[model samples]
Target chain A: MTDPVVKATALRKCYGDLCAVDGVDFEIGRGECFGLLGPNGAGKTTTVKMLTCALPVTGGDLTVEGLSVKEDPRAIKYLLGVCPQEVNLDPDFSVVKNLVVYSRYYDIPRAEAEKRAAELIARFHLHDKLERPVEDLSGGMKKRLLLARALINRPRLLVLDEPTTGLDPQSRRQIWQEVRDMKKNGLTTLLTTHYIEEAELLCDRLVIMDNGRIIEQGTPRQLIEKHLPGGGNLEDVFLKLTGKHLRDE
Target chain B: MNNSLAGSLSYRAWYMWRRNVDVSLVTWKTNVLPPLLEPVLYILAFGFGLGAYVQQISYAGRAWDYLAFMAPGMVAVGVMFHSVFDTMYGAFVRLRYQKTFDALITTPLSPEDILAGEILSGATKGLFAGAAILLVVTLFGLAQYPSSLLILPLSALAGLLFASFGLYFAALAPYIDNLNLPVFLFINPMFLFSGTFFPLDGLPAWVRLLAELLPLTHLVNITRAATLGLLSPSLGWDLLYLVLLTPAVAWLAIAKMKARLIK
Candidate 1:
């Protein structure tokens, strides 16, 4: 197997008296779609935030591309692209302007930013609404734009937090198809979700998490065979591991 | 980036400022007119309307036109008002309601860069407002000195100072309603007592001492001196006061905002 792109040892995050993430360990290999499966308050978002440098790790050794998150968060940020769980697009800007302005943070030249923005807009099927404000877009369109934006810097690793949550099946499939296409082009993804089907369809290997700890891990098929002996999928395995139904938060 | 002063600043901050500018340009028709006209209205009411009855006034041992005296103070007021609102309300909307800062933090941009960009953008708005007042005063023939051109740079400095104050207060504010405390208690007091509408000489001794401590008082002094071509003994002190206080407040603003934005 290729070297891991991300490695964590005893990862932890504490909020005053509450320990949101506690002593979790995992490794995500290069070019692999690694799923972090958990129920609400399982510290999924906190772990992701730590990885993205949005929050400092309280205690742990977490590294991306051999650079420590604690020591070099700014450098790690350049190698990764993030699609947050919430829709945080600029409401005042148009579809085109939103992408164009975002590219500037990377110091992308004007001509290059324009070209890449157009390409992503076309790829995401935002051609018709290039001039329309972000508030005008449908739920699915905004998610697609978020995906397109995450790819603007041509990052090697993509971090998606509940990427397809609340989307209609059609929109979900559209995103799935895009993820598949990007994976085929050798993209690495770290996805967190409660969706069993999404995890099964996309992730090569995953770890089931509960109470800030990894309970079980392996390929989807391995997890099924190891946990649910008779017959089942990731959802059945999740239930067997956590013993609680996963509900939307 | 390191926590040092130079390390906190980045060229990427210009991009953040550019984002605000781009959005501002889209609403230019609506945004441009208010800053331009509000000062003119203030000029008409205070400079022209009040000046007719007040006639000449003795300011700093010299007799001067009341309109000319008040005009520069209005310019300083516009810069302070615009910068404070931009950093306080405008920054708040992006921070809480819009979640723009959250989106920005995910990128290569650091919290310091975001705060710096905000400071720059707020200052730009203040400069715009100050320039508008300068134009009105010039057309109204209240500006007599070639030194009036210095008002633009002076207002820019005033803009930076007030913007820092706004951002610092925003860091401590919990909700939209909480912002009212600073606006009323801090900003309003500065606006009324900074000699924007009247001479500070006649105010009580304690009041003058209190005004001397406010940042706007120094800014108003420099602005009036620059516009009227009358150099006070305190002009050097005024410039030095603003120059030193600006960076100190700016550093505090950035550190405070970083705490709020970075978690």
Candidate 2:
């Protein structure tokens, strides 16, 4: 698809003998909002970890921004932003310092990094909390700050692992606006989520994976139309995509 | 193209050094102050009360007083212990509870850079504590050997070596219970047996050799040589010992971190 910006072929990840990802092949176009829609334990996070070089690929080949993660993980990481599900901010550092030190880890120039951080903080409506500690912030403020910190490097590809989970409605809407802004700015996103509505609203195209493999792939409208008449709802679509078997995992 | 790991490691070390200084100030109460009180007690207990009874540094080849000879060694020991403790506890907390390394692995920084930066921060903490102890030593007129200035840098190096070892423990520490074993088995034993309080020369030959095998031995020896002005034993060998051990420990730490990161 238009010379994919990210190409993962036969990506296989195993935790010991348990194959978490089994021969999954996928691609994401430049500036495309791609979604990996799945239930829990559906290999979405495992794939994300492999894509971001956070987890070792037992057997596979993957590339991000035309760079091979195997050969150039550091360079690829430089061009990618990851908003993890867990907000692991340094509580000791002030908001500004949190952004500041994080940027330094990427070898981003201090002056430029600080300036960019200030601009992002202002843009994200977090200017007042610049001097505040992380533990003192509201849940929503912390979530937004997490996203801001992720985007501090202005990455080419944004990989979000359940980016919107555990957010209040207002915070979710705020995050949705930021994600939309990222898409409008032509930043490609590879998002993983169990929320069918999030995938429907935000994703341009999607894949529904179960048991470490993509069972179906197409635009959200396409999957809804081809599988369900009238393309009315996603809960029915998800049920049809997956069986009634409860995912205890 | 010269893409040596050191280029990146050094850059990260410098970068992390800057961040840690900022953090050190923010948590100055937690990171810097607790370490401050620790040495004050050690100096008071050993130098004030014990110094009177054991006031003769006969082995130091003069009657300078035990505190005078031990003060520099204590500073070295403080830097070593505190740096190692700071790194292990901070890194273990980050690795286990905070998952900071999990977050950092997603960035452009490699495992080597993370290890280098963390170890550098530990060394910086050591320098801070060592400097504070030096001030106290100066106020009491306890510093006899003028060459002890070199001990500061030597202690910093030794601090890094110990912190590297600490980072290795942290990388492997999978749980809270697993965390305590290393400090108990490895760190405390090194402290007691490193000849921190007593002379190693009088120990059994194998015991002395085991002490020599540890990093603290080289550290305390250098500091003692500096404070007592006893360089006839060769400072170059001491420096060589630290030089050789520093990279090895740092490399092990990096390798362990890299293994852990490839999750």
Candidate 3:
């Protein structure tokens, strides 16, 4: 097999006395939709941060596109797009300007950036909101804009951290559709979400994590059958594996 | 430059600076007017209002009208305030509230590049404000010597110096309210005691000693001397101090900001 788009061997991240991601191993193939399913503080965000080079990896071997993150992070950044849990949009910019300014960070030329931005704006159904300030857009529109901004670099790996946490059902489905379309176009995606339905619908292969450890890994159907013999959706399997404790505290 | 420093800074910083200009231009009416008007207001209140009572003063080894002496000082003060406010409050908004810094970091830009871009943007604001004051003073016939034009670059350097200081404060500030401490305690006192409104030579020895320790004092000295066509040997030291202090403070700002930004 061609090398997985992402490969992590005993991947780990630690914060002082606390270990966020501990001894997890995974490989994500090209064009496959991989999900890291976990409750809050389950090291999902930390794993994504390490993968995107936003946070340094404390230990273990991790590589994206066959490039070592520790040796040349800039090269790795070029190949990955991240949609953070927070909106983090530049409110000072207009909808189109946000995309354009983001495109510039990758050193895309003005003419090409404009063309690419126009394509993305149209694809994301943001044509009408082009001239509007980012603050004026709804939460869903902000999420869509964030997705488009992530695509500006035309990355090889797309990492989404709770992409639909706050969105309404319609918006969430719309984003799901977008992710499905991107997957059909052969884009590799690594998504982290607590919503088992989102993981079941979007992830081709997934790992259920709790407290920095991956307890199970399989196809959604296999996980549902293996964990819940009665056979239920991912939410049942998720509860079976991760428990229904109140994680908010 | 070592590989680490070289890696930290890049031409990508220009994109960060351009981002600021794009947003500032959208609200130019609110953003541009204050900086342009502030020095003129100072000139009116102090240069004309107070100069009427004060006689011509001998400063920098030459005699000039009080307005002339005060104009350069006002320009320096304008640069200082512009850079500090632009970087401190503006950067805090981007870092904490807007989360723009988080967005930028995801891109190919490094933390150092972001910090450098912020410093450049702050310095550019200072330069524009200083230039506006220079133009207003020149139009009023207060700035006599053509050599005063050198104040433009000097102001830019001072902007970098003050912006680095602002970023240092920003990196350490835990909450937005913590920012008020520096403005009230450090910046305001620096403004009053940095030989801007009056000559430091006339102040007490200890006070003068404290003034010399302030960055604005060196900037003011450079601006006043450069504007009055009074280049002296000590001017080199002033330039050298700002030149050396900028990168040192920037290095500190970058390290602190990295720790705060990168988890």
Candidate 4:
């Protein structure tokens, strides 16, 4: 790949005695969707947090677009559009206001912000809910608005943390369709989720993480073919490698 | 550079401040009502009703009526309440329940930028409330002209000091209820003992010294001087105290918040 959009060399994060993301490495090329697949406590979110500069790196180094996260996090953040795991939309703001106010953080001009907000609103089919408060929107609309807000900055890299974790099938498929469209537009994305189907369908290349380490990394089909040998999907490959015991238990 | 104090801040701080301003605008009626009306109530209860019993008070070495003496104190108190409460309760809600800070960090804003914005917004609220009280006092003919105008800027400075104090407590608070500790223990004492209701000179030597340590005491001193047109060279010390202490506390507040949020 020419000039990877994201590169991590032994990235690590620790909370006192607990090391959440042990040394892990991966790279995502421009226009590629990379997946970090893992169970709860397997450090997928931790690694993502470090990549997004929300959490400090305890050891190792990470660079986005060749700028070190330790050195130029603000610059890296400018290039990132993050949709957090939780719905953090400003409940007091209408859907349009939420997008416009968020655009100010990037120093985007108000007129430009409004124009981009209008475009994203139409794309996400949230034009009808333009004046409605975020709290008033349905679950699916909230998720779609979040995606619209994330795209407002015209970020080079999109970081999604469980974008469709609790959504219904219809909502999840809508999100999947947006991701697919973003991929077609050559927007590089880094996604972390345990849903094997989501990872298999969207990710161009992926890594399976467990106990703060990358246990496997390859194209979804390559991993399935190599791990299963005969006839199984990425889910079977994941279960076989990471074990079926419930992670939270 | 990212971790250093100087490097962590930028013009982006204003955007965070603007975000709060936008929210306040939506609730502008509720936001304006307290500052506009609270002074009138306090003036009736304390300045008129209680002033009748205690007619004259000595301040800045002049015999002044009780209403005139306490009017400036009201402005100081307004500054304290608006700045401290906004940063303490309002900021705590945004930080913990709303996850506003989480959302901000995802963008180009640093933790310092966020805290600076919060403190700035808190100071702006203090200025608004103080100005409102200043208007009320002027209407009562208690505040003198040109000299009293100084209170507007003084309110901003005191606002910064109090806002920093509130933000520090917010960083230390583990739960929303724990914010009450500073209010009851720190702010309540300052409100009563900061020469708002009476002169601190009558108190014991140590008590006066202790009151002097409270930021609001100094704020009251300068504001009282400004409102009464009794500006004195001695008031320079009070101004110095607030000016010196605000930046130190603001730096510490931002550092503490960064330690709490950026881990």
Please name the candidate that would achieve the greatest lDDT relative to the true structure. Answer: 4
Q: Interface RMSD, candidate 1?
A: 1.6
Q: Candidate 1 residues B99-148, lDDT tens each?
A: 89989887888888888899999999899899888888888877757788
TM-score, cand. 4 vs. native: 0.97
Sorted on DockQ, best first, the list reads: 4, 1, 3, 2
Score candidate 3 by lDDT: 0.87
**Per-residue alpha-carbon lDDT of model 4 for B224-260, expressed as tens digits?**
9899888989889999999999999999999998888
Writing each residue's lDDT as its tens digit, candidate 4 over A163-244 gives 9988999999999999999999999999988689999999999999999999999999999889988988999999999999
Candidate 3 structure quality by residue, lDDT tens digits, B134-226: 888788876657678889888888888888889889989999999999999899998888888888888899999989888898888888877
For residue A95, what is the lDDT in candidate 3? 87
Q: Between the candidate structures 1 and 2, which one is better when assessed by TM-score? A: 1
TM-score of chain B of 1: 0.95
Across residues B89-141, which tens digit of lDDT does each residue of candidate 2 receive? Answer: 88788776777877887887666667688898888888877878877877877
Worst 10-residue stretch by lDDT in candidate 2 chain B? Answer: B1-10
Give the Cα-based TM-score of candidate 3 against the true structure.
Answer: 0.97
Candidate 2 lDDT for residue B259: 74
- Report fnat for all candidates as fractions from 0 to 1: 0.59, 0.69, 0.61, 0.73
User: Model 3, B32: alpha-carbon shift in Å?
Assistant: 2.6
Structural similarity to truth (TM-score) of each candidate:
0.96, 0.93, 0.97, 0.97
Q: DockQ: which candidate is best? A: 4
